[model samples]
Target: MPKKLKLILINSSILLIGIILIELCFGGWFSSSNQLSNLGIIKDAKFEFDVRNLYATKKQSITYTRDKFGLRGISTYNQPEKIKILTVGGSTTDQRYLDDSQTWQEILEKTYRDNGKEMYISNAGVDGQSTYGHLKSTEIWFPKIEKLQPEIILFYIGINDFYRVNSDAKYDDIQQMESGGFVSQIKDKSVLYNAYRKLKGIQKATKFEVGHRKINFSRTPYTQEEIVNEKLLEIYDKKNLTAFKSRVKKLIVYAKSVNATPIFITQPTLTYRIRNGVVYGTEATKYLEEKYAYNGVGYYKLLSKLNDAITEVAGKKYVINLSNEEDWNIMDFYDYYHNTPIGAKKIGEKIYQNLTELGFVK
Candidate 1:
């Protein structure tokens, strides 16, 4: 063979190998096994569902329907005369696992209507939100609520606030926002973003299952209830407590300025009990300790401080202590922090009852 021809052939072979290696690494070829295993799908089986089509489609109407974001019903304008209620909170208020009909907001709306009182309720809950997020949302969406002229604004928050307040997570305030880090920058790259955008459905489902697997593997022995009373208590201090209080106060003043009665509900968490002469921690506590050896007592203390602050801001009339009552069991919680449909219904009923007493509802 000619020396130049031989060298060309060798270079081509090396180039082919390099291309194959690149395809295997960042091209997601090597990620298939892990994705399939997480999905519990058969190896080499072609996926039938178009996950992109499923998730990417925009919802048209809100009435009597669920949105891609898992929110129930629609926002209606110029409804017949009835008491209007607006719910604002995080995932618990969003009711991700529950259908539109099963959410507490829906339950409360139905109850009010059943009792011969006309009412309209709008759910302004978003998942993975914090107190600051709620405040921001209110600032943005208050005009929409104003159009409806809701009589009451019910806010269910604290868990996410507690998490963010104690953790090293950076928040983006209007005054000072942090720029994305290196990994975030790469993920935001146009080429990579476009590629993932093309395959977003499969990517999202794969990512979801992977996340669930990771969380399951990282489970701790303690339940959420145990962490609430124990681990959450240990982290309580004056500084964070004061900050939390100031936020609550700001929220109260904001709510009042809108001429909408502000009702704060202290949502519930999973609880533990002494069984067989042994004490068991809640799942959240167990998961936290097993994965990060996190101090549950600290979190509990923080919650205590938050509750205290809420009470101070709301006074006796506005703050609703849902967690304090035995009728509202801690076991009703779906996970470490969120409530099941049944739990949400219970909360909704309590809120309805309170509103009736306060003349917010007839």
Candidate 2:
């Protein structure tokens, strides 16, 4: 045994012992506190902290909480017999920037309770999740929710589908990418992975964009007869629209299979506007016009087509058509699509109103 080799072995043994002790003493606490353990893994995931934790994003700041199931909003896991309404969607449904009481699901629950009806709502929204993500999540979380035996399963989805199609990504491809492989599994358990996530979080914290304030245009630029790019039609291609519709249909089928009434919503966005017959909109809207050619269609036209597909697949009775609703404006939105707390309240109220009007909820 060379003296140099002995020294190296001794130092390595000491380092390993130190790491083991640190992990044994603090790894659980660190991971649990970081709350990034299951950040991407949504199934049966729980937030690291308890109720009333303040979570601030680029748009707004609000006290956020997660149920024991990791779903946003308060946990009603113990409350059996409450008419459970599981609301699902992308970041809009997530509404993490809104306090638990201000969320539409919470507002709905409170409204029902105030009216002497027992109701519980769980939010199953994930940021950036599209129909592709929803389909997979429903597969994983549907049965778990079935145990709760929810009466109405509300889906506030659509805009993300458009975003996905526009991004030139396929649902199947996204599913595969998100489905962690062997390497991801190993990386997920690494301390370095947690550190990287924390770093990203810090970066996000520093660069938060406030709610989508109104963009003041000096004057109406495009007239009714102005010429616009023809590529806007390509935003909603038949291929992506078919995929979106198919996934939505599958969601409805899955809900019905569990005997849960499924409700589809045509998401509203600031992307729609009519100016002198010119369908001009935000940068994204203009980007579609210049980037892709789709039979000379407009951006809003593509959104309408997607909305129509949702309504066609879900049927009129079960679909909440907010696309044509006049209330959603720049004030209601925090970005191109996600809603402000006010917007969330209006949406929540609308859902409640529609549900009652349709006699889905008594």
Candidate 3:
């Protein structure tokens, strides 16, 4: 090789190795904006949403309008003859991509009307909210919603809690986790670093395939670096689980005090993929799977633990498990938890069915 070319190759090799080491040591570090917390505020915002499919690769656009309450549906607060229902959750429930008529909350309203009943269901979902945010909403937004005298309050939670576990100090005190300094930022912007990560990811996928896993989609392969420590999971569960239980209790108690029945909904994600009629993969079938895997404590596991806490505290009769529905497909999801219109309608119908079966509604 020419002397200059040899030197260039050596430097590139060192850089690649260095970035991989950094990624391993500081796995969950990501660049996030403070503006991501547009929770229960920011009235009358209009959003133009667009996305292109990865496979079919077609561009799609949808316009969304938020009412004065920063929710996705009609902005009215009063209806005399209609049963008032309030839906609370994160982005999945917020659903900023769909039109007003496409939301599951709106679908539920129409479903009730078809059954000869009227419902004024309000969507109170906000982006990036967790149980902590939901609890805070009770003070910030719920009072406003309470004016409608909501006969039922629905809580959909878990995905954000699972994600915040990585960066939020409240979950595990892993303050060192967000150690993306100057070099890290550089790596994020560098084309070379991204290429290296992709190559490494492909290698991991190949290994999974060789091991008969037969699944790959834009996921980072699991290594010890990606696994959230078992001890951390235990500690996180201990602290957050208690807080989750207390928050659910508060929501339920407050709902009952107003003669409103409280229903807790478990958040679900597309965590698995099937190919050729065989089960192929696991948690976070979309983005970086390693983060959701959290070492060995999978995202679904954390969510399940939180859901279990809800069911135990709220009782089985008032809880609905939508996390592992068999009929949901990848095309129904735009991301981990946020859904396309189809998924929203599915959840809406399921909740409607449950409400009737439990006699919470006619």
> Each candidate: what lDDT?
0.54, 0.61, 0.61
TM for every model, in the order presented, reads 0.59, 0.67, 0.65
Give model 3's TM-score versus the native structure: 0.65
* lDDT by residue (tens digit), candidate 2, 1-362: 99999999999999999877765453433454323333343333433322222222343445566644556656464343353777788777886556666788887777677767777888878765677667756654444443566788888887656545444454245344356686544334445444565475344323322122333333323222222344434435546676677777888987888688999877776655443444545432233313453221244566778888888899899888877776565556655465656777787778778778888776
Q: Of models 1 and 3, which has the larger TM-score?
A: 3
**Full-model lDDT, candidate 1:** 0.54
Native RMSD of candidate 2 (Å): 7.4
Output the worst ten-in-a-row residue range by lDDT, candidate 1.
Answer: 208-217
lDDT score at residue 122, model 3, on the 0-100 scale: 79
Runs of candidate 3 with Cα error greater than 4 angstroms are 1-40, 51-60, 75-83, 144-146, 164-228, 273-297
Please provide, for model 1 over 1-362, each residue's C-alpha lDDT reduced to its tens digit, 9 standing for 90 to 100.
Answer: 99999999999999988866654554433463332222211122211222222112133222233332222444332231232677778767776555556678888888887899777786667655567656645543344322445577788878766644344223323222123466433332323343553364344334322111112212445543433333324434534565566667767777778677888888665433334434344443322322333334434445556777888878868888764554544435544555555677787888888777866675
Name the best candidate (by TM-score): 2
Identify the runs in model 2 with alpha carbons over 4 angstroms from their true place.
1-61, 75-83, 144-146, 171-237, 273-280, 283-285, 288-290, 293-297
